[model samples]
Target: MAKFFQKNKTIHDENKLEIVSDKSPFAYVEAYKTLRTNMNFLSRNSQYKKLLLTSSIPGEGKSSVSINLARVLAENGKRVLLIDCDMRKPMLHRYLRAQRFRSRGLSTVLSGNSTLEESIATFSDLQFDLMTAGPIPPNPTELLASAEMGNLLELLETRYDYIICDTPPVSLVTDAAILSEYCDGVLLVVRQKYATFQQVKRAKQNLQNVHAQILGCVLNQYDVSKNVRESAGSAYYHYQYGDTKLASDGMMQ
Candidate 1:
C-alpha cells in the first residue's frame, strides 16, 4: 500500500540494493509489512509455514523479496529461518552481508560435511536465523530433491514458525518445483517489464505439473510513476495475490 521510488538502479543492482531494515525508508519498510500482512491473511486458515519463493526467470528480485519477507515475519515476533536454496547463484549471503558464514550452510549440512547448528548463521540484529547456500554443489537439483532436503525441512519446521526458502527460477531449473513439494506454499516473484507472459505461464505450469500450491504472486520493481501522481520519479515493488485464473491468464504485463 505504501509507495516510493528507487532511482537509477534496479532492485537487483548490488550498488543500490534495497533491503528492509530498521533504518530503511518508511515507505520501503511499510511495503514489506503490507506483504507480510497479506501472507498472514492468506494462510490464516491453513498451516503455511514453509514457504518457497521463485520466479519465472533470474534477476526478478525474488531473493530480495524472500529476505525482506522473512525479516518482516520475524519482526512480527515469529521464529523464522531463511534458507538460500538458490545454490547455483546464491545471493542471500551477499544480500545479508554475511559472507564470512557462507563457507558452511545448507549445502554443507545436507552433504553431511557440517551439522545444522554449525551451518546456520545467527545475526545479533536480526530476529531470524539464516542458512546460506554453502559452496555451490555440482548437483544442485539432485541435492535439493534428495531425502536429506525433506528431512531438513521437517526438522526445521518443528523449530521455527516459518522456513522460507529462496530457490532458483522455476523456468530455469527444477529446483523450485522440487523443493515446493516440501513447502506449504509457493510465492512467485514477477518483476515488472522483466518477465514475459509466456515465461510466467510456463513457470506456473511447471509448478502445477508438480502440484505445488501456488499461493500468489509478488509484483516486483513496479513502476509506480504511472499509477501514482506523486511517485513520478521512481519505481517500487508491489505485492499481489494471483488467483488460479489470474495466474493462468499470465499475470505479467
Candidate 2:
C-alpha cells in the first residue's frame, strides 16, 4: 500500500477542501484500509453491495469517510460507485473537484430527467465513479424514497461491485432512513466530541424504524493530540470500528 501512494502530497488541495486521500499519509490511508477490511469481513458471507453512510448530523465527516472508503475499495480493484445522496448539502463533487459534473447526478437521474449512465462523473485517476447530488431538488426526501431511486440502485448494483451512498444526516432528515431500505446495510458515523449520544440514539432509531441493517459504527475525527499524542503536528486521522453494540453514550463501542 505504501508503494502505491502518491508521496509528498497533502490530503487536501486548498483550504483543506478537495480530497487527497490517495495522497494522505500512510497512517491515514491505512486507517481507511482498515475500514475497508472490516467492511469486507462483515459482508463476506452476504451479498451486501449497496452500503449507505450517514452521521447523526452534518459536519461529522460522513462525506469524507464515504469518499475515502470508496477510493480505498477502488484501489483494491473493486468497481466502486460513490453517490452523493445528501441532496440538502451535496459536497462530494466539490470534495472530488468534479463540480462540473454535479449538475447531472443522483437527483437529476431520479427525477426522470437523465440516465445514470449519463449522470455519473468518472474519475479516471482514482479508478472510481461518482454520482453527485444533482441540482438539489425541491423535495430531496420524496425523490429518494420514490420507486425510481430504488430501481436505479438495483440497476447500478449489477454494474458495480459497490454502491456507496453518502446521504443526509439521519437525524436531520428522513432521507437516510428512506434510502436505507434499499441498501444492503448502513454504516453510522460518530465523530468524537461532536456527535452527542442522544443524536446517535435517534439516528439509530431512524435506521431501525426502516429495518435497515446496521453493519457497525465508525469512530471519526479522533483527536490524536489529546490521547494518541504521538501524531501531534502531523496530518493525523483515526478510524476505529466500535463494537457491534450501540452504547448509551451515543456511539457504538
Candidate 3:
C-alpha cells in the first residue's frame, strides 16, 4: 500500500496568510509527485486544456487546491492560469493578497464592460495569471451561462497551457454546473469527513448530466492516520486474495 502523508496545520501569527513556499520540504515536493500525476493524467486524456476546480459546497478548500495545483504545474514548466470564478463571494484575491486585479476580471470581461486584455491580471512572481470575479454582478449565474462566458474561456484556452478555474460550489448554486460545460474537464474537491459520499455522488451525477468530463476527486483535509489504516485494510484484503488463489492452484495440481 502507498504511504499516506502526515501534515499538521500551521499556526501563522495573525497575518492569516499560509506560507507555502516550495522551499518547505513538504510544500511542493512531498505533494509534487501526487499533483503532477494528476496533472499529467488530465493533460493526456480529456483534451483538457482548461479545468474547473469546484466542490459540492463551500469551505471545501477548492480555491487552495486550485492554487497549489496551478503552482505545481507551473513548476513543471507548464504555463498555467488560475481564475477566480466565484463572483458572489470572491476570496482568491484575499487568499493571495492580490487586491489590484479584482477590479477588472471575469465579470467585467463577460459583461462586455471590459476587454479581455484589460480584465486579466498577471502575477509575474507567481508565474501564473489570475482573473478575479470582478465587481459582484446582480446576476452571476446568468452571466456565466451566456455566450460571452464561453468565448472568454475559449480565448484563454488559446493563450494558456493550462487554464484552471476556481468556481463556486455546485450544491450551493448552479454556477459551477453551468460553467462545467464550458470547461475541458471538472475536478471535484471533496472535504474530508465534511463532505458526505452522497454529496460527492450527487455532484458527479450533476456534472455527468451536463456532459462535463469529471477528471476525478481530490480528497482535501484527509486525516493521515485514518487513511493509512484504510489503505492497510485494502492491502490485507488483496494479500489474502492472492494467497487463497495460490493455495487453490496448488491444491488443483
lDDT of 2 at 164: 98
Question: Best-fitting candidate, measured by lDDT?
Answer: 1
Candidate 2 vs candidate 3: the TM-score winner is 2
RMSD of each: 8.1, 7.2, 13.3
Q: Model 1: per-residue lDDT, tens digit, 112-214? A: 9999888887654566788999998999999999999999999999999999999988997799999999999999988877789999999999999999999
Candidates by TM-score, descending order: 2, 1, 3
Backbone clashes counted, model 2: 1
lDDT per residue, candidate 3, 5-116, as tens digits?
Answer: 2132221322242323444334224453586676788678657888898887665667767766776677677888888888887877765565666778889888888887
lDDT of 2 at 195: 73
**Candidate 1 wrong stretches, greater than 4 Å:** 1-15, 225-253
Local distance difference test scores for all models: 0.77, 0.74, 0.67
Clashing pairs in 1: none
C-alpha TM-score for every candidate: 0.83, 0.84, 0.79
